[model samples]
Target: MILKTYRWSFVVTALGLVLAAWYGLSAHLGIGQAIALVLILSILEISLSFDNAVVNATILERMSDFWRKIFLSVGIIIAVFGMRLVFPIVLVSVTAGLGPIEVIRLALEGGDPETPGTYGYELHEAHPTIASFGGMFLLMLFLNFIFGEKEHHWLGPIERALEKVGKLDYVQVIVAGAVLLVVAETFATEHGRTVLASGLAGIVTYLLVNGLGELFNVEDHVEHEDPATTSAGTTASGVNGPSGAARATGKAAFFLFLYLEVLDASFSFDGVIGAFAITSDPVIIAIGLGVGAMYIRSMTVHLVEEGTLAQYPYLENGALWAIGALAVILLLSIEVEIPEVVTGLIGLAFIVASLISSIRYNRAHPEEAHVEQHHAAQPG
Candidate 1:
């Protein structure tokens, strides 16, 4: 079933190959170079976003079948086009006051990568604002995950201690706000105000999206007062039938969907910006990132179907830490340029360590893993 679910990934990847060939022909690039670059881009995206896939799987499992389909389908469109294409255009349009046609021209054909005049080149000029917003949102995501009371921990004492700190009233917001201020102050005078404004906006966006999702979830809970139970008497979502989780409609699901989109966008911000390093061509960037995103969605489904998260709890912990590191790097990038490879490696390192840690945990606490697996069988 999991393999079948990834059929779309195969299709998208095939299309990426086609697009890569066409791009190479147009750019007069060697065929080998084109395919190689695409492959490299795809691999880079997968490496940077594997943690994203795991995090998404956790959220996607709780969603209804309808919402999950929307996640894989409509969500992919947004990830590919919205962030990869239109978002950059909008950013350039806003920063440069350029028209749509002009922005497209600038993005695709304008100045060389090394010099000004290209959209890719100009995008960095607004890096302070972009990084501020994206960095703060990512910071909140990281803070919430690490600060939450998790069921399992790879680093027991540290996570347990953080879980205790999570209980403090408004701790997430307070700490995030303080961190944002500190980062904003580091920005040079020319962009300090802009950075602060963008950072605050990012914080607000996270709060609003999260608060709305929670409010809608409360409504969903009220509407479905009677939760279903599994054979072992574990709790489940009432709407889910035998074949699948119940079709979760209503305002709650709607808000949750929006929250997820925003969350996904925040995760994608770095990849989109960092992509300019490899290729200045927006079309290629979109194709490569789109292909990569589809696989991520497929991998997410695979994880859910295989119950990877329940079996390996520390994986999510590592993803959260990686997110935290990325956020910090983004903040620092406001003042200094950090290579995309470094960011990818940092995340990959965390994931690899988490995998090893999870394996050790599974061996040491096989019974605990079994218990988690049993609970995982219940529909959310």
Candidate 2:
């Protein structure tokens, strides 16, 4: 029955294709060519993103079943609408002086709406700005992944320090705000503006969502933690879960989703640029890439439900390191001429090698195979 339910993956794949076709129809792409493009892009995206799904599963498996379901449903909306749709429009708005409606039209048309001379000129025109935004974005990701702090901050020393400074809380807030403003004012470059606006948007979004979460205290999907399973399993307090394992897992899944979104955006950066390299038509690009995004999502859920990551832990780590490498490539692309398809191939090679290694590792580590079977058989 679990596997039967998971078969909804096919339905999702179908839905994505349908949407891509619709976009193609609106844009006047020939139906046959549109279908072919969608299929190719979908396969490419899915193959490239298999590692991402494994990484996600490693975290999502720990969430409560209810929360996992909610993640599958609601998170898809955020991925499709927020990242796939709204994000591109934001890029257009920031770089092209176009309002959202016109931006939507441009994307639907895949930039083919304008005359060849004008559309091609505008796209080339926006390349510098797009490259700038993408470059900084990828650099931040690389640094954060390779060098950023990874410690858990649940009531950590920083929080303790904040508590101690409660007497001067207003002063602390003011100082932090002033420091940020000064940095933004001092830079005053396009890159600087991008960083400020994006970072502030992120912080505001987090605060708003967190405030609501606390207000609602939605605990219906919280799971019982298991200590034997996780490092943080014994340390969590409150209704955090039984052993802290579940809570830690849920938290990790939330962040992992964020990381995947970032990676997806990065991948899209190159794909979008490269699509224009092929043709300036925005419809073909949308249909192709939209279908591609769908397949990636489906593969992610499949890898999770099938426990692929657990069956191959080294593969999971390898995929992460590969992602780190790709982050570097994306940042480098801001100034350099690395091909997006080449970057994709390298990432995919890492995942495929890892998959092979996982198969070999599982052959040697028979106990892991048994454990996965046991877990797979457990009732939700």
Candidate 3:
């Protein structure tokens, strides 16, 4: 089962390493150094994106198989070539007011990241806006998750309290707006307006994507019906066939797919920028990060197929908290230089703790474990 799930990841790793070797041999760096750099970058990306896989699994489980296939195929292309490679160049071009061709030339002519007019330098200069936009988007995701109701809870006291407060209307928006205001007023005083605008854009993007998903979702409108009927993909409530309440389909699935892609982009913002610290070569960065992204996609699919989220109920909660931590770190990074290792470690800590907690829960509630396992064994 494991081999079946990760077969494509292995294929991607092999291809990425070969490409990394070619780029290294073609460039000034030796093949050995290039391969080493790619490996390190790949590990860095995987470590930082573990929580991303969990969150993605949670969403992907609700999507139809067709959309899931699109995610693995078309979505991987966007994540690799688009976000990891082209997006950085585009960002630099816009921020430095240079043409895309010029930006590509500058990137190929890599120099010291500390030096002016270099690709790394220009990308670094755009970090504030990137942080603001990505930070706010991730913050909104974390906020909405915590402020919304859930059947299970991890960090029970805190989550319960937040859920109680969430009974109030638009609490998530109010809190997110307040945070943006504070960030703009204090930490981003120099580029306050820019930061504010970027943050607002992030918030709006989230609302648009999430709102569209909810608007198109048919499950909410399905009336309460017999469990047997619902399980058979026919609700007595008159919602017929497989689209009844089992999975998102049609326009609803598309928006959820969009939301997942945007979430992936938000997660990648920091990884792309931090890649420069390890190597300034764009080719190596893309090869390495692209390899890592493929594995994350595989992991998401594995988690969904195995029903890992159902088996370990608190996993999603932990991932959301880690996202909240990351969002805070991104916002704080605007004023203070938080190390990428620090960000990665903080997220890993949350995941590890949650896994241990899940184990304990399963031990104490063996019957619940049996129930979850039975459900997991059933098809979506």
Candidate 4:
């Protein structure tokens, strides 16, 4: 059943191409290039997003069915529009004073043929500030992934002190708000404004969307029910219930996926910019990256349904490390000269290695599925 659901993403991509080609053939746009661009970009997005799948698998695994659906639908909107479309345009508008629509138009037309300093809407004439910003941003992500604190609840003495002043929620809000303020202020400088803005924007966006989901109860209810295939009765200790540990594990996976999306955007900063070197057509870029985005979304669901994460614990570790690494690369791409293709390849290698390791681990640890089934039978 899970496999059947995922196959549709592939089908959707093929259908999109056919539709794009038909539209192109009716006009001056080259059908062949449009189709090729879509295929290439889609594949590139998918490859770049392997870590995304793994991460999402972790998160989606915990969400209720309704929330999972929302993640697929609403999450896609956020990924495509927020990251691919709105993100780049914001950078252009802030740094170059170009209108968003005009910039988008330039991207679609492949830049201005008669322009002096710019390539399409892309400013070839401006300082390499964008690249530097990307580099520095990616650097920070890498550092955080490698060295930042992992999930922690207690905080011991610190928690106690904060608890006296207010609830944990208040403290978190205060910290997050302060971070956003600092990030916003840092962007006030002329040189690294876009870079800072991008990071701040990501943080803010996550906060808003995430807050909405939380406030509106847009979370997965996997904690409440099990999928149809799994049995829902009995326990190892005759406890007549499912394991709390397994339910907790699934919940953890779901949140991990949320974090993964945030991580993917950080990686995408370079790709989105590098894509300008190829073409500026928003429609074309959208078609290409959109297709890739679709596949990643489906792949994420597959990993969870298949219990791949539980089967290969190392895959989770690998994905976390990859996200961390990509984050740093994105920061550096702001100011540095690293190629987008290089970033994609490195991320691809990490995800692929993790996947291969997972498959091998699955062969050796076949019972992993049974454990997942056992947990599934026990309800969310």
- Which one is best on lDDT? 3
User: How high is each candidate's TM-score?
Assistant: 0.89, 0.65, 0.93, 0.67
lDDT digits (tens) for residues 128-178 of candidate 1: 888888889888888787677565676888988987998898898899988
> Against the true structure, whose TM-score is highest?
3
- In candidate 2, position 66 carries an lDDT of 57
Model 2 TM-score on a 0 to 1 scale: 0.65
Model 2: per-residue Cα lDDT over 1-380, one tens digit each:
34554455566657656765775576676666666776675565565555556555544555556556665676666655665456656766656777777766665444442454234445544544454444344333322222322222222464345434544534422433453344345533445565455435433433343234334334543455444543321110011222224432344445434544554564456566665555555555555566566555556656656655555545554565566566456434434578757877887887777677767766987986677555544444
lDDT of 3 by residue, 239-297 (tens): 12332236676887788788889999999988998899999989899999999999999
**lDDT tens per residue, model 4, 15-94:** 76986697567646789977887777777777676776776675566555655666677777777778777776666665
* Local distance difference test scores for all models: 0.75, 0.51, 0.85, 0.55
In angstroms, the error of model 3 at 324 is 0.3
Kindly give the stretch of ten consecutive residues in candidate 4 with the minimal lDDT sum: 234-243
**lDDT-better candidate, 1 vs 4:** 1
Candidate 3, run of 10 with poorest lDDT: 230-239
Q: Is candidate 1 or candidate 3 better by TM-score?
A: 3
Residue 276 lDDT (model 2): 58
lDDT of 3 at 94: 91
